[model samples]
Target: MTDRTVTVAEAGESAVLDVLSGEPADVGDDPVGNGDDAAVLGPAAATVVTTDMLVEGTHFRLDVTNWSDLGRRAVAQNVSDVLAMGADCTRILVALAVPGHTTMADIADLSEGIHGEAARSGALVVGGDLTRADVVVVGITAIGTLPYGHAPVRLDGARPGDRIGLTGLPGCSAAGLALLLDGRGDGPLQQAHRVPTTPIGSGAAARRAGATSLTDVSDGLLRDLAALARASGVAADLDGGALPVHPDLRQAAADLGATDIDARVLDWMLDGGEDHGLLGTFPPGVDVPPEFTIIGRVRAGEPGLVTLDGVPRIPGGWDSARGAN
Candidate 1:
């Protein structure tokens, strides 16, 4: 069905709450959710806050994804930051600025996506605002608490000789984007880019295993890892052979009938973004959680440098202000 344009008056605060269906957070002091001017949340032993926004035509496109996916992806972006800090998100605040022509049903779908993903992460919806804009921009703020230990993981703690591990697949969403651009829509690989999933439980697992540093692969493996390396003041030696490539990329390549599929797939793994996978450094001899696949090691070398199979990996990452790589 085609979406209808919804006005700010028609999609009021009550309508927004009804669309969410009380699916957001329930742990806060303001249990009623979305009626008052502000929300009150519980005090934490250590609380972490993160905010991320997804703008149409920049972070996403309406032609490829529906409003529901948009909402979920927006929430996912915020959650990944908390998870990167080695915490589980406890609540979310969603602010939506939509075009005047947007439909009420579309708003509902967006709320459904946000609430659904938050529920999956065991996070509740707190409160936010709906304002008018020329285009769609979904801003989400995630509040998280350290679940496993005294301190949340940071990007600056990695040491030389530490093992580098990644908690989820990195290239799936990139492959999905490739498939979508190649006109294969609605397939599994294509959907990966539309509503990409992350390893939700791995943050706590990494904390339990005493992860020294952590961050998620948002911009690209090398790009994000390079940031981690710079933060930790160490070198990250990535193993090209050890990096796990999702088979879907190869499948997409086969379907596209492309030459040099292996090299192209490697490019996607190396430079793609939006995967939401956690990458971290662990102490030597520490047993990484089962979900982590060791793809590299922190070693003595140039600080903030990353190498793949001992060769320096040049940065050709996705730059939002410029364009996707």
Candidate 2:
């Protein structure tokens, strides 16, 4: 195979930025270059900001994913937070800490991935800094804007009588992760683990449909939803049978040689993290979006109480200090 590695000096920070931001000479609405110290954003009724970091061996592994996919994942995760607020991401800042062994082509591919994701989300990459490290690290900060007369959706907004719904697949990433660990799954399963994509537009759709509260599944579904319930001081009861467990999860379990594949898949759906799917609570009588599936409903109970089929759901999830998987 041809060598694709390059030293920091060989790649040069400016060259990498050029690759990501487009030719330095071409000026867009907000030109991305080494000159600007900060990005000037449009005046909006409300602004929402969130940041996330991905470190080697923690959030990802170089052996399992490529630079381009990693870049996309780094952006996608931060965007998820913005989406949770029921706002649209307008811009992002990307910072990198790369080891000496990382290649120039690697950075180029990563930049391409970031640019592609930003375009898909209708966001721009404005600025960032490059630094040295023993391993690859990505830090992304996403800025979002809400329309006039709209407010950022908060976890505390959920109330009794609200309906709970979810957009897209929740357990695919976790199942993909299992496949990766088993080292016996196909490319798609491994791809989901490396760079899972969320339905970025679902947040706006939820807002339009009068969602009372919203959250993204960065952590396991139960864990994150439990936090939302705690913040709202209510209970979230989920129908165990209502979960939209992706078909791929069952296949992944079988591929991993699990005896009770159905039960294992259920476990992954409840406890798996990093799917980036959006979960929201809507006020009673409000119409949920077509993209969403009604999984359960909100009710009065002990604060932070989350149950699956009337039984208390076990608390197990992704911990930054401890691996989520």
**After TM-score superposition, what is the CA distance of residue 88 in candidate 1 from its true location, in Å?**
1.0
lDDT of 1 at 306: 93
What stretches of model 1 exceed 4 Å from their correct place?
1-14, 17-25, 28-33, 147-149
| Model 2 Cα shift for residue 5 (angstroms) | 5.3
Sequence-dependent TM-score of model 2 = 0.93
Off by over 4 Å in 2: 1-5, 23-35
Q: Lowest summed lDDT over 10 consecutive residues: which window, candidate 1?
A: 1-10
TM-score, every prediction: 0.93, 0.93
Tens-place lDDT per residue, model 2, 182-292, is: 765466657777787877788988988888899998888998899999999999899888888676777778878889988888878888888888989999888888888
RMSD of each: 2.6, 2.5
All models: lDDT? 0.82, 0.82
